[model samples]
Target: MSKKAYPYVLIMPSVLFLLAFFVYPFLQVFAQAFTHSEGGLTIAHFETIFYDFNFLPSLKNTLLLALVVVPAQLCLAIGMALMISKMEKGRDTVLYVWTIPLGISDLAAGIIWLGLLDQNGFINSFLFHVGIIDEAQSWLNYQNPWAIFAAIVFAEIWRATAILLVILVSGIGLIPKEYYEAAEIFGANAWVRLWKVTLPLLRPSLQTALILRTLLAFEVFAVVMILGGSNMPVLMGEAYNWAFSYRDAGAAAAYAVVILVLSLLFTLFYLRVLRVPKEAQI
Candidate 1:
């Protein structure tokens, strides 16, 4: 087929899929957000989702979790990638062990953590045997924000780090042996070689890891609900409550749109920071 014919043929499936699955639902949600039985073409749904104090708290909580988790994941992933790349044996075993959590369901992980943090849970049982405490403390129900934050951090890190690890490893593989060999011959120690060669070479991979992990952290749902409970605020959980519990689809759609916009903004900000040059000099 000609180029013009090929473009339409290549896009036809995607266009059909979008129309069938995406466009119609988006239109419905947009209509609901904009219209009311009494008030026509009003922004009340968005106003409620944004201006409401409850929503702000949820939004704030989400941002806080993402900010804390994303950077930590990237750092840990970098270390893991470097270590795995340098390993002469059992590298596959270590990679499998680390990524095993990726296959574990978020809800299952939450339930597992609940058991660990519960009153009569294994941790408490062991500590009691060791005479560490007279009774089991409420690790999950602690009034301190750090308690919930810690659980969120743990869950996010456990599940998401593998994605970064895989991406980083792929990037590391593309860096030719000659580059690292050259660095070694220049009297560059392991740390120096990592800084000058590995880190620079991994910039594109770093950007991808950051963007994906950051967005997922922002919208963390099942684990948060299971570990932290609905008493605490997180954007997606709050949106679920609005849509299902309260039967407010408009508000839920508004919240979803807000999250989508925030994700796009973050991507733009990261691209600006990376500012990848045309030449593959890195």
Candidate 2:
């Protein structure tokens, strides 16, 4: 093959895989979302979802969860990454321990939290034994929306912060030691150096991690289902309900499209806010 053609050939498998798995399914969903079951294109599916009682609450919950969880995770991950970076010993062991949650599936994480938060579970058992409460409390019930939301948030943060930690740690490592040395020589302290030197240089990695984590946050499902159940409606849960429980493919597709649009808009926002100049990339 010609040199120009060889590059395309090298990427052919990936392209074909994306076309078959991603592009094809996306087109199918888009068509189902807009087209009437019997014939030509229509907006009925969108209208149905827009009019659904659950739609607004689900949308709000999804956005609220993402907003709350992503920032908390980002802060925690950055702090952990900095601690690991400064360690003189056992860094690998510490990192391995911290990332243990990464090996646990989302459902498993949710279940583990559920066991702790359940009325009859460890927290209540401990509280009762310690005379903190006269009896077990229904922490995960529909009446305890705050507790339910907090449980899901904590579970998600525990399970996913490792993703950002790993990315930030790698980005910090890529930074040349000379930069630190120069900053130190100029009398820049740790905090000053972090803001002036580290974070600015780490923009690319921040952009990447934020985009990935935000997208995953928007699509959160298994954990929410396991922890909050129908008490906490989210976009993904509503989509699943429409598709499977209600057997309305078009409505499900519309929910999926809403999620896709949100993801795309946030991605563009990150790209704009965190855009690194070509000259600044390490």
Candidate 3:
């Protein structure tokens, strides 16, 4: 090979790897969605997916979880980031403490919560021991899926909030002290300072964190499976059930396409609302 050609040869490997691993799979799924049985080319699978009873409900739940978790997490992350950034001592330790739960797998978090909230579980055992209830109340049962949803939300928030915190902290670091001091000198309280000074500057990071958290929440499966049960049925879980339990790849792929569309729409909506000026990919 020519001397100058060696660099192109070395870079070719990564380009090929991305095409083989990422581009190929995405293309295949998209292709499958268009080609179906009993029809050479059609939207049958999409129709079936949309018409399925659980499909709409699952989509609704997925959107609802994202709606609830994203704002709640962003708010909590902002507070934690502010607290961590403001502190002079133990700031490093607190940052690490926040990061510790990021290592927790979804399955592990689900199981831990299951243990705590199970009937005659730690929470109930304590309540019963303390005479808070006359009987062992089933905190997370089938009839009441909200409690299970709550557990899933808590587990998700506990495990995922740290990443958002880190994002905000990095944003906080990028902010100059002059803005904060100026706000203070103007007789602005903490809320006013946060809304008027801090949040506007934190926009890019907040936008990123929001998109990441919301997308992840849409694909919430492992935790829901482990804690909420397959019967409880979140969007991803229902997709998994269709794909694996019923061995329906066409439907599964269609569901995946639906999720992809929803995620993209959400991200675009957020970017538009935030008025992100550049189309920079992060």
Clashing pairs in 1: none
The candidate maximizing TM-score is 2
Per-residue CA lDDT of model 3 for 17-117, tens digit only, reads 99999989988887777887665887888888788888877887777777777788888999999999999999999899888888888878778878888
lDDT of 2 by residue, 106-150 (tens): 989989999998988899999999999998998898988988999
What's the true lDDT of residue 276 in model 3? 48
* Candidate 2 pairs with clashing backbones: none
Q: What is the TM-score of each candidate against the true structure?
A: 0.90, 0.96, 0.89
Best-fitting candidate, measured by lDDT?
A: 2
User: Which pairs of residues collide in model 3?
Assistant: none
Clash count, one per candidate: 0, 0, 0
Worst 10 residues of 2 by lDDT: 113-122
Q: Candidate 3: TM-score? A: 0.89
Error of 3 at 62 (Å): 1.0
Candidate 2: regions farther than 4 A off: none
- Candidate 3: how large is its RMSD? 3.4
